[model samples]
Target: MQEIHPLLQPKKYRFIDQSTLGPGFSALQSFAMDDALSISVGEQISPTAARLWVHHNTIVLGIPDARLPYIDKGMDYLHEAGYEVIIRNSGGLAVVLDEGVMNLSLIFPNSKDLNIHEGYDAMVEFVRFLFADLTDEIEAYEITQSYCPGKYDLSIGGKKFAGISQRRVKQGSAVQIYLDVTGSGYERAALLKHFYEISKLGEETRFEYPTIDPSVMASLNELLGTSLTVEDVRERILKQLSEFSEAVVTHPLEGEEIEWFTKRLDQMIVRNEKARENLK
Candidate 1:
């Protein structure tokens, strides 16, 4: 496994530890941060980055999630039930996030010669390495019963605790994954399942939706039988990143990057508005 990871050889890596940014923030704030990082990488003004984030009571939806028959009602339900909803410009269906959910995005160059598999492999390897001390039983396989199930879903003992997604902009790619580090996996899965049931309302669509199984999801705290908080995992990520490379660079969005993010966020807001309007 070590042989496979170092072989990929990303040019440079930056690790952003944003896990302490409270339990909740606006989706636009997070999008702005990603946009800033994307611009930096695309311009070759910065190295590759592994960013960690966590948000509370938020339901991040895919483009299709907004098209459900009663999605407007669902969004209202989510709001009434205390969850902020937003559409991500990436792959995957709706996912629940809270203080327990840790999100990491591996940002890398996307040149003509760069292989897509390289990005995917890098994430899979990084995750395995982070938890090497805990257990080596984690496997990369499709956990269909899990919400937002995908081929690259990260699982342990056939129960999913993480899902991977990717977003590319110009010459930069951000491979994203959300790790359920702690809290009630059933509660989270139930949230997503209810979101689907309320939104889709048995409506048939061209895309096949996931039939979320609450049983197939488990938090690190539950899976390991040890209480592991998101902060603990965040620290582990920093430690692993520091161990993996020399001179790990950590910094917030620069002024120049912030300007670019502002522009990108406006575009994101426009896209989100369209999605919301569709639901209405």
Candidate 2:
């Protein structure tokens, strides 16, 4: 097993939990908040932060997903299925987010000094450390049949439960990962599969969309044979983060941070507007 990097273990870190935010709180705000914190941490206004977030019944699409030939049709399907859709300001294809899915963003400073893979390796190592007691089988590799499949996809026994992605701004970087903590990963994959079936059935696209196989995905609860809620894993995250840092500071977004958030949030809205124009 490879050793965890020292960069991931900051001496001091900021912890922010937005997972308890009610349904009315949009995932859009989470994206903007991360971007703002990334800039703040990069500029030394805030410590390197770990933020926990969850969004209910939302399908966050990548830029390419918005270009699907019959995406408007798929958008209607998602709307009818009670899932709010938005295009994220980062890489990766469509991914499902519900109460059972937990999102983590590790914002770090000095992006210029860290290579992209190093950032992803830090996240992969952190996650491996988080669940070290549960299972040593957790592996990071592309589960090609899963939505938002990537080389850093985290899985156990051939079933994917999480995916990692990175977004960089200014001199700060946010390495994000979404873990299917509870409920059904297969159901989520099925939803995305149906979406692609409807969205690209008749269209010939240049981009190679994933052929989602529902069996290839399963939640951690199912894989570990433990009834773990997102809150449970949230606690696990906090505990592991505490072990990695000397002090964990709970910081609130204020003043200039709020301003940055508002600006980035508006930009996110504008980006989504263009992405969802035909769908709406």
Tell me the tens digit of each residue's lDDT in model 2 across 133-175: 8999989999999999999999999999999999898989999
Query: lDDT by residue for model 1 over 150-246, one digit each (tens)?
Result: 8889989998999888777778877888999888888899888887888778888778888988999999878888888787888888777767666
- Candidate 1 off by > 4 Å: 7-12
In the predicted model 1, the residue pairs found to clash are: none
Best by TM-score: 2
lDDT of 1 at 186: 85
lDDT of 2 at 195: 98
Cα shift from native, residue 276, model 1 (Å) = 0.7
Task: Give candidate 2's TM-score.
Answer: 0.97
